[model samples]
Target: MRRPRYYTPTEVSLHNTIDDLWVSYLGRVYNLTPLVEEYKGNILLKPIIENAGKDISHWFDPETKDIRTHIDPISRCVKYYTPRGRFVHVPPPCPRSDWVNDFGKPWWRDGRFEVGLLTAKTRWIRIINTLTSQEQMLEVCSEDTLDEILQCYLYYNSHAASYTWKYDGVNLDMSKTLSENGIPDKDEEFYQCLMDRDLYTESICLYFNDDLSEI
Candidate 1:
């Protein structure tokens, strides 16, 4: 048997449109294009369409009443319709094969629609500046863009207080990964040193910073 391939969030974000819909559940990626086609006219299809190309594990929990309400009616309903003077029972919109197990695992175990695994773990990092003794933390993922990280930092740090703070390890390049710029993993739990460009001295410290611009 071949090992399952892993996919980054960046790759998953590319398939956000309805035509190429995909979603992740419990770290498993599923291409939902066929499901979209099958449930086109069904009311139950609305949620699936709304959350295309996103992680929907939270939406499909077995214990949640939302999933039960959305799926149970469609899964159990058998309506009779007259066609050509003959009454025929119309099957539910949800295909039997698409039914999920207790853990929300799909019944169709075929590898064809199984795209890849969500590999990166999201972590919240606490950053402290040695020079100012100021600290802050933000949630980030390994696949997050440099600009996204910076925006998060700015959003959290931006307040009534103003200080000309420079991210020591990060450079002008906003395309590189934090890991590439020397930001330690969450497990490291070590304080990183920050530098003041004007001071030319290693007086500041930060938990994580990327030096992509310097590269």
Candidate 2:
């Protein structure tokens, strides 16, 4: 058996189009492109389309009576649909056996279209101004690079032009990974980085003056 692949929420969000729909439910990612194409105009299609490229756990959650009632028909459809009546042989009701193991938990269990696991959640990091002690939290993903984080901060804080960032007393190297720079693991609530004086003043001046060497 092949090992299961894992994907981040951001990775799954990229497949939001009708031709490449994906959704996360109970930490599992499902690629519903084939089903979406097969049931394009069916009544069951609405919820899938509405929740495409997003998590739908709350919709069919076992504790929720409202969405559960709504999903019952979709589950029954999956259990009984026959494709074009070619009748060579009946394919299993659901593609995967685990899906068929439980009928009442959620309709997602009735569809055997899982793609991978949703492994990463958005993390918030605190970027503190060392000079003024002012702090701001920024949302980022595990796959984001230091450069991307810096760019986000710069975009949000206009005063970033006057400051640079430091992690654990060292200058934040834009080329480094967040993990490499000691950013905490997932759900940490708040990881901190210090804002320091920008040391690139001379380099910026030289670059503007057409000095490629300093760049």
Candidate 3:
């Protein structure tokens, strides 16, 4: 079964620009660049633009999984609570004749803008090549499979896919997560022991398979 892609906060933060805005909320990440382009000249875009490449989880209600709401002080009626002012698709606090509700669905509820889910946790891992004795420290998401981790390792070793990965003397299942492969995350233990996070990393040895496809 295919799993959803996971993104670290650092990867999402890099897209903090007008043409590539991204934000995360409630463990989900969204690429709001289209929303930005659709409402380019609208002043309601201020908050979204200013907050590009950031997490706006506070803008939503965890249980309801929707935008936060509050009662209108003067009218004694409930309305969308936007301290930064209303943005695109959000109805005005008060009803207005010009307000239109024909946009099909609100951007927040639209899944089209969503890119992927945020990784729940991150940990340091060291990858060492048995062939050349090269080593690199990498921070990886707990939910990531070995194949995904290999993609990150490509920066260090271009022949990562040509290697057989192993934790100890046993071979690893590339389709499964690190935990599923019996490699437990020790980040919490490292933290409790006051160990230097930089010095504390799980070692994964890679043996060359002699595959020449990458060459």
How many pairs of residues collide in each model?
8, 0, 0
The model with the greater lDDT, 1 or 3, is 3
lDDT of 1 by residue, 1-215 (tens): 95455566665767877688887876778887876665567665566667777876664444431222232344465432222221112233446874434533332244567787786675455555554577665556666655555556665554212222324644324565556655545343332344332232122134333432321
Candidate 3 achieves a global lDDT of: 0.88
Q: Ten consecutive residues with minimal summed lDDT in candidate 2?
A: 200-209
- Summarize candidate 2's per-residue lDDT along 1-215 as a digit string, tens digits: 95456667887888998899999877788988877776576654665676679987665444532233322264555332322221112234446662332334333554578877776665557777665566666656555666666667766555464555566566665666567777545332222333332321111110011222211
Q: What is the lDDT of residue 152 in candidate 1?
A: 64
Q: Which candidate is the best by lDDT?
A: 3
**Off by more than 4 A, model 1:** 62-112, 122-215
Residue pairs in steric clash, candidate 3? Answer: none
Candidate 3 residue spans exceeding 4 A from truth: none
Rank by TM-score, descending? Answer: 3, 2, 1
- lDDT agreement with native, every candidate: 0.52, 0.57, 0.88
